[model samples]
Target: MRLLITGGAGFIGANFVHSSVRVHPEDSLTVLDAMTYAGSRESLAAVENDIRLVQGDITDAELANKLVAESDAVVHFAAETHVDNALADPEPFLRANVIGTFTVLEAVRAHGVRLHHVSTDEVYGDLELGNARRFTESTPYNPSSPYSSTKAASDMLVRAWVRSYGVRATISNCSNNYGPYQHVEKFIPRQITNVLTGRRPKLYGSGTNVRDWIHVDDHNSAVRRILADGQIGRTYLIGAEEERDNLSVMRAILRLMDRDPDDFDHVADRAGHDLRYAIDPSALYDELGWAPKHTDFEDGLRATIDWYRDNETWWGPLKDATEAKYEGRGQ
Candidate 1:
């Protein structure tokens, strides 16, 4: 199969691209990425020779149309995904997440190609801490931040196209992902890189915010499963059911790195920070027989730490600037 993977040089997308090359050697892969500050070519270094990487904006309708016209399937992953960045300025998020998705929707609609839209569970907003309820396929949209609102809009666009234009598309909303090639601005990688660089980890607010964490590889595997066997016009939630609070996760990182658990500093939390997010991936499992392999969160963290430790050259250049941006926000 010939596949067009948008944003394939970004964190989860890069991992997906690598896995595609390793697992589906018979398939030809092409990656379209804008190489934004959050994305880097170095992330695709290992699989650079295995796939074709196109550096272009997804909002370019002509480019999106040309690529979609030649592909068997298109996995759309390009977007401005950082909450902090979106909070600072929402214009880019509107352009990338909304307009870019519109472009992709039109292309796939025009070409009669299958499409899988990758989304985040944040679009369901946050559940109260200690709530037993988790987000499922039936959850209503209640996006909190500009970043999530844009993603919610994109997801809506896919659903609308599927109904209105008969576009062959499916959607998967995933929980928080942590693994290699992730940007330093994200929570887990920021803390891990801080420890490796001799800086204390920073926790937000009381550190009670809970997030359902899943390894990137596991997330990508579930996505592949959906693309292969999932029913059209259905939305599946992907999660490993690994729920951890910020404080506990930070303490675990500190303990694993041989530091005092309470050595971390507390920073002001961002406005509209969701108290918790949990996902129930029952539909993904029961309907598609998909299950996450990285069930052990600590083990995943250890491997992730090792990756960042060994690949300092890949993350080091962006550390200072990332921290500086956070510092400005007092978070």
Candidate 2:
């Protein structure tokens, strides 16, 4: 199979590319990335020689169409995904998430190629902190921030194209992903990097916000499973069933790094912050016989810490800028 992966230099997409190379050596892979601030070629360093890397914008319909025409499947992952960034300026999110998705949808629809649209569970908005209900495939979207709203729009576009144009597509809305190659701005990497750099971790508000965490590898594995056996016009939710509140995760990181659990500062939380997000991935588990290998949150988090500890060169350059941005916001 020939695969064209958009945003393959970014976190989850890069991990997906690396895993695909190892698991399916026969498939030819091509990556299209814009090399945005959040994306780096260094993330794809390990598999650089194995896959063709094309630096381009996904919103370019001509580029998207040319690549889609020559591929068996396209995994659309390009987007402006940072919530903080999106909240500050929504124009980029609108252009990339909405227009980029439309470009890819048109290309795939024209070429009659299969597509897998990766999305986040934030589109379902927040459930009350103690609520037992989790987001499922049928959950109605209630996006709270510009980031999630754009993603929600992209997901809807994929669904509409599937029904309206008979486009072959599948969508998977995943929970929070934490593993290597993740940007430092994300919660897990930010705190982990802070401790590694001799800084105290920062917690937002009361730190009660909960997120269903899943290892990056586990998330990608489920994506591959969906591509192989998932039905068309279907949306699958992917999660590891490892839900942890912000305070608990912060304390765990500090404890693992030999710091006092309560040694962190409390920063003002962002506006419209969701209280909780949980995903029910029963459809992926029952229908596709898929499960996450990293069921232990602390263990996976430990491995993630080790990755940052050992790969300072990979994240060191961006640390100061990232911290400065947060510090400027008084967060």
Estimate, for each residue in 70-93, the C-alpha lDDT of model 2 and write its tens digit.
999999889899999998899999
TM for candidate 2 is: 0.99
What are the lDDT scores of the predictions, listed in order?
Answer: 0.95, 0.95
The TM-score values for the models, in the order shown, are: 0.99, 0.99
Cα lDDT of model 1 by residue, 91-176, tens digit: 99999999999999999999999999999999999999888999989989999999999999999999999999999999999999
| Candidate 1, backbone clash total | 0
Off by over 4 Å in 1: none
